[model samples]
Target: MRWTKYWWLVMAVMLISTFAVFAVHDEAKGPEKFGRYEFKEQDKKAATDECDAGGKPGPEFVPTVRDKEPNLALLKDAKPEASSQLEGWCPRRHCVEYLNDGFYNNCRSWIIGAIPGWAQIDIGDVANVNRIYFGSDHSQGFLDRTTADFDILVATSKADPNSDANTWTKVYTHKGDPISETTEFTFKDVEARWLRLHIRTNGGARVDEIEIYGGKDPMDVEPSGKATTTWGEIKTE
Candidate 1:
């Protein structure tokens, strides 16, 4: 019986030793097997091809003059009228209405001229614009006012070319006593389709033109028509 028990113990030890060696071998080779399976040459080639096809550098984009022209088909032919005439001549120049006297005391303050005389335009499809320019006549005067305050509004409804009391969405406003002709006002990150100019001041002033160059120009459907009549026929005292 003692001899049989010793033999059984030896057999058990050998089996355990064999199992431990196999386990160690598997552990050592496990990483190599996994590496071979996880990373294939074909897979690497496919990834490289995809990167070369989709991740290639593109040329710099630019906006052309054709992109800036208004699409007459999408726009309403209706002209926008002035909602209010704070001062100046009625239907003065491009202004729908001019207020001779009232708030500013006959100082020739044209309130809310045409909404969006000029629009902001973007260089690329997705680039954010930072600058804008508006056309102006030196004779019409630069934004000169001792207490000049104005706002830029985005409107969903078309402006009345004959009235100045229309409702609009105010996108931006400048709150200062007044700005000099030499001073330039800069605005940032203003998103709007239709921009309106609101002027409130205690001094006489005029804005001949406005342009928005850096940002995306509100998608203008049509250009404003030329004025045929003088300022008197368009507004009343």
Candidate 2:
């Protein structure tokens, strides 16, 4: 009877420890819901203010265009593709084709759902790429409809480039309360043939353009003119 009692005590202790571990794991995961979104408390506050106010949530973003260096993604041999097309309303507008087209207003590339979305550009051959300029359509009038967080990934491979299973080196990770109309991110030069924009979370985004540049640092270049098509033309087109 004493041996049986000891066995029960051991089982009870094991159960308690297991529950404690589970509690810790959940705590480490952090809060599951931040208002309507699925991360961070700050974002929740920003999102709340966005709705509370009748206007835009954050400051308007104006992009300083870089004219000195060429946009490598615009190369004739370069190709861009996405994980999937965002279906329903504006089906033609939200597509992978518009990603590098130099338009910031007319059409946008969208990726929505619990599963993350990815957009990648194959810059033909390996090049020293370090700067990326990303834009989202702010005309939509909702901060939640913009990229919240994403990652910049690079890879050099000849086979199955589109496959998620392929090895990719993450160069930068962007955490945006709301990604700007034109957000520029720079990293150490990576000699790569493929560049990927992995969208981890977006409420409902209209990713307008992603321009990849190689060679010179954009800061050294003088701003001669805007790099993208003017808003006046894009809205009409």
lDDT of 1 by residue, 31-126 (tens): 111211111111222322322112212111111111242211112221223444333443323243211110111111233433323221111121
Q: Tens-digit lDDT track for model 2 on 29-134?
A: 1232322222112232332332222332222211222444556665545677777656753433555765654334323344443447777888776667777876
- Which has the greatest lDDT? 2
Cα-lDDT of candidate 2? 0.53
Q: For model 1, what is the error of residue 77's alpha carbon versus the real structure, in angstroms, after optimal superposition?
A: 7.0
Against the reference, the lDDT scores of all candidates come to 0.30, 0.53
Off by over 4 Å in 1: 1-80, 86-94, 97-147, 157-169, 182-184, 214-237
Q: Name the weakest run of 10 consecutive residues (lDDT summed) in model 2.
A: 228-237
TM-score of 1: 0.33
Instruction: Score every model by TM-score.
Output: 0.33, 0.57
